[model samples]
Target: MEDPSLYFPLPTIKTLLQTFYSSFLFCFLRVFPLCLALLFETLVLVHKWSFLGHLLFVSAVVLYTTLVYHFSRPAPVYLVDFACYKPPSHLQVPLHSFMEHSSRFGCFEKESVEFMGRVIKLSGQGERTSLPPALHYIPPRTGHLDSVEEAHMILFSVMEDLLAKTRVNPSEIDVLVVNCSGFCPSPSLSSMVMHRFKLRDNVKTFSLGGMGCGAGVIAVDVAQTLLKLCSGAQAVVLSTEIMSTGWYSGKERKKLMLNCLFRMGGSAALLQSGPQAARVAKYQLRHMVRTHMGASDRGYFSAMREEDSEGITGVSLERDLMQVAGEILRMNIGALGSRVLPLSEKFWYSFSLFHKRFLDPKTEIYVPNFKLVIHHFCIPPSGKALLRELGKGLRLKKVDLEPALMTLHRFGNQSSSSLWYELAYMEAKGRVKRGDRVWQLGTGSGPKCNSAIWECISPVNPLAKVGSDPAGPWFDCIDEYPIAMDDF
Candidate 1:
């Protein structure tokens, strides 16, 4: 069978008719009022009304039009600030230490030990990447208590930093969203955050689990939706992956990839919707597009949690993961391009699609130049190979991929929070300027691809001092970045 993803979904006759009808109705409503105003003005002119009367009438019309336009539009959402957790240097596990620790565990076979070592060395992760304190112990303490401790350390630290920087009281937070792909406790992470900060009882709370690395953007999408409903509300999203309980003890190489790739980290961001917040916010949300291919068997099983022959449970990474990721990414960007791409690019892309489908089956489809609309990119820093594939597919230059590559080397794959770390790297380097548009692309299990666009509304200086804490996550090492890819 031909690939279903090869063709984009076309608008049906019903959809076209709905669009036409909406457009006609909107135009008629707008024009009818203007025609009435014109008629009233003509009557006033013919009747020789007083100048003051005419001025009052025109002012009333203008005022009414402004109010209608203002109330009709949805409130804008703003990203006030964000913070990424920087674990203590004591938690840093060098490659040799990590290998030694793994070998110390008698559960792994010799070949599995060697496989993990090779994966780590070529994984584009540096020696300074951190692991949880529990993992540092001999024989490793992988249990419920240890997982909760790790979660507390990461989630609370990032939340504290974000709250301090934004100075927004917990009582004022109208919504709280906490996402951890692998771990979900009894009370929920969102409830834990609320209790820790003593937030309002009525605060809207949501805890998302099993959504994989893309859940960060998914959580932000959820917050944005809620903010629209509650006018002038503030929301906070916390993203992280708890790996203490997620360690794979089995010999399955596919399951072991997660052990090598994921590291300890978390991020918290504050988003608010209102005119007042926009004045002080860093970025204004522009567009968000999410694509899911879970309906297909290959996509659904691409990455899944299951047991080995020994019944040792772990998340498996199928060999075809990259293929599935590429397909989902293509569909996601195609949807996003329709909304953000200029008319010229859209026209050529549509023409190429038509030609390829009808005129010449051999013709290749055109890839829209996203760089035309986006100034910076923060794609998932999952691994070097995936990053390289995405860079090539998107036609991104080395400079454009610098943030992701460097973030991977310095912090490893933080799962949902990896994209935020990449964004932080860019800010710490003083690269993000006012009016620059940033695109954050995230992909994960469920074979999902999500994209978020942010327009910098105000200047973002290098985070030299985050509320007198000395510096941001990358402040100490920002100057040393843009390292040669060959070094990894």
Candidate 2:
């Protein structure tokens, strides 16, 4: 894909008119209040009203303004804590061992085995990444029962850890969201969580499937929206992909890519609303932006799950996958920049747009420096190539890209839960500080991209608490990281 920073669309006449109208309405609302206050003062002076009457009128205006401001603002959402599941050592699949097992399975042709081996060798995944117990079987048991076991193992483990870390009782949860892109059983994952945790009877539960890896951020957005309708509500978002059922036994090269990349992992996050939660929260929600490009054929099919020619089902990543990702990411960040960028950054971007559109059509448009607002980034680590491309497009330094690269090396691609693992890595290293802003960017099979901005509200040091809880994904291996990307 070409550099996405150069692809800003020119403003159309209709969009310009809408912008003008909105700006006028905002100004009118502000000026209207002042105009009414002035008119009341004029009446007191012209009619020679008593001093007590004027005082009463001024007090009423002040009360009205205070009420309007209080009612118009939305409640703030806080991230109390989050946890990522770390599979037992027995489940780790070393690279060479994976290739040896594939060769002996007898289901794959020699060419297919070679293709997978080559992909894994250059895939940037380390030997410690894990696979489900069912996948470790010689023939791979991909039955419904096996998939259910995988789901329970991951979902329950992450939730248990999260609840323990946050010290939040199950009865206090008012909302539950579970997102797994490839699995949707009869009972639904949300129901399973509620039953296992014995949550309140009236909790709002949501189970989202087939939304792809970006669904993690989508789940956060859903929880935030629901919290706004009630006071002091708590919500939990569980993100995972059940790899047992997602495995493909086919030989098609496109379908085989999934086998080399995805691994077993999951994450659970606790979010709460209101001022009380904010006092103890680690991070405060700042902004969220989502973009979907599935309307066009190229984007919709860029990464899709379908049956191969041999009648075996698997996800096929087309050649245009990178192109679609770049396009959607550009759109998502463009919207986010409008909300979070500093005033100077916005001015330069707008000036460039005007210069390119009217003053000089040949002039290059400016891409806002996101680093000015974002202190840390947790981006999708689908592969090394995609990560490198995104870093270049966003003008990020190598240090800014290390968290994602190291996460991929340590855990492979855990689908929706990968972002949390990256964040956990930062926390374990004590790289996140109070007042820092962390941006999580997620992309998935829908050719969709979503962004979540979080402002750190308190100190986060997982290593300091490791003595009591050795739960961080990188608690054991953080010191070994920042290894040369080439070494992996």
Candidate 3:
């Protein structure tokens, strides 16, 4: 009889050598353990030879490195040799029937009423037979080709507009980055851009899909990183949310909110490694704080809600999401504290530490005195309640959420492009001046909260004014100060 262990016997030297012909496998097997051992030894030596000390030391090093990296990170000041295009505002769904027609595909059953209410509210008190055409989507008759085809079409349309605006030869673009939240298929967005535009064979391209509303910022981060690697590459980034190819969780009110909120929107931004770009909304990327609280799997499951059973449909955010959102904020606060908080706050905490442990030895109190630095705020149009909750959680002032609420009311949640819209609103109002810092926060169903901070480097673009219209200049539009939910 064969020994039980023989059924899973290890390979002999010759067998191992034969199998190790796969270079990648051989390299990992041969090198990874050695590297790990050396790292472990180095870490041990750096500490007092205690496991806990090693862990603390390594964590401190990582934290310090990240802080220094951010502090020393080059602030990008580039002109947006870019143009925004809305496919004939007539494409906008009318307030009376936009949701009725779009939600018939079994996705809008629960929150259709809520969505319709927002649409009507945004249209204003006066009823007009012909409102300006909304940039809208052709509702997907089926979800299969919804995102893939639509993403391609949206990017193509935007690229043509950008190319026309910049008058730059399509071939001159050294790099391309495209991001779509719901639509990613064969020939990823980057490759498709290369093939569609016929760029040089080795043109650098990147496709970021499924990053959700925060993807616009994430794409900016990607472009920022890529720009660091190339000396003279021009990068174009496209962001959109394809509503047509969406999967909806059947009738779940929590899930249906997206159908009511998200609409057709896309923006194409061009970036170059040059200081001249400071004229446009100077792309002075400031601190980017990303925190993943995913280790709390229970917390993850709590916020998990799939628009489709197979997890391939439209994204449905859960209702109990505030709980997860709170956790995410905690993680981000810890991750970003070092970068955003002044040394005074840290010193105060340290003093409190000594006071509690050795001096008073009775209680512990650690309060971080952080001054609010958000000059402009852009948050997801999850809901009025959600916005309110965020304000309370973050201790945000009423003025902070005003722009966000106004945009949500007017645009009905333009998905990833909403922040850009808010940015436009701020510029229109002249709230964003040189050196002002703005924070954009995005929330999605992964119960994800992503934040990006941009520091102004130059004056706002007078010609390319954001959200400017006959209604009024940006400031005039905001005359009704301290916007609140009741106004909407």
Q: List the residue pairs that clash in candidate 1.
A: none
State every prediction's TM-score relative to the real structure: 0.88, 0.89, 0.68
Query: Model 3: per-residue lDDT, tens digit, 96-208?
Result: 56555555544444456556557455533122111112223333344555456566666777777677655666676766878776667777878877888887665678887
By lDDT, who's the top model here? Answer: 1
- Expressed as tens digits, the lDDT of each residue in 143-245 for candidate 1 is 9999999999989889999989988878778899999999999889998888899987678899999889999999999999988654467899999999898
Q: After superposition, how far is residue 74 of candidate 2 from its true place, in Å?
A: 1.7
- Work out how many backbone clashes candidate 2 has: 0
User: How many pairs in model 1 have backbone atoms within 3 A of each other, for residues 3 or more apart or on separate chains, i.e. clashes?
Assistant: 0
Clashes of each: 0, 0, 9
Q: What is the C-alpha RMSD of each candidate to the true structure, in Å?
A: 9.9, 10.1, 13.5
Residue 312, candidate 3: Cα error in Å is: 9.5
Q: In angstroms, what RMSD does candidate 2 have relative to the true structure?
A: 10.1
Per-residue lDDT for 146 in model 2? Answer: 95
Ranking 1 against 2 by TM-score, winner: 2
TM-score result, candidate 1: 0.88
How well is each residue in 163-265 modelled by candidate 2, as lDDT tens digits? 8888888877889999999999989999999889998777899999988889999999999998765546789999999999999898889989989988899
Residue pair clashes in candidate 3: 78-277, 79-277, 89-133, 89-134, 90-133, 92-134, 247-313, 247-314, 428-474
Q: Which residue runs does candidate 2 get wrong by more than 4 Å?
A: 1-46, 50-55, 355-364, 464-471
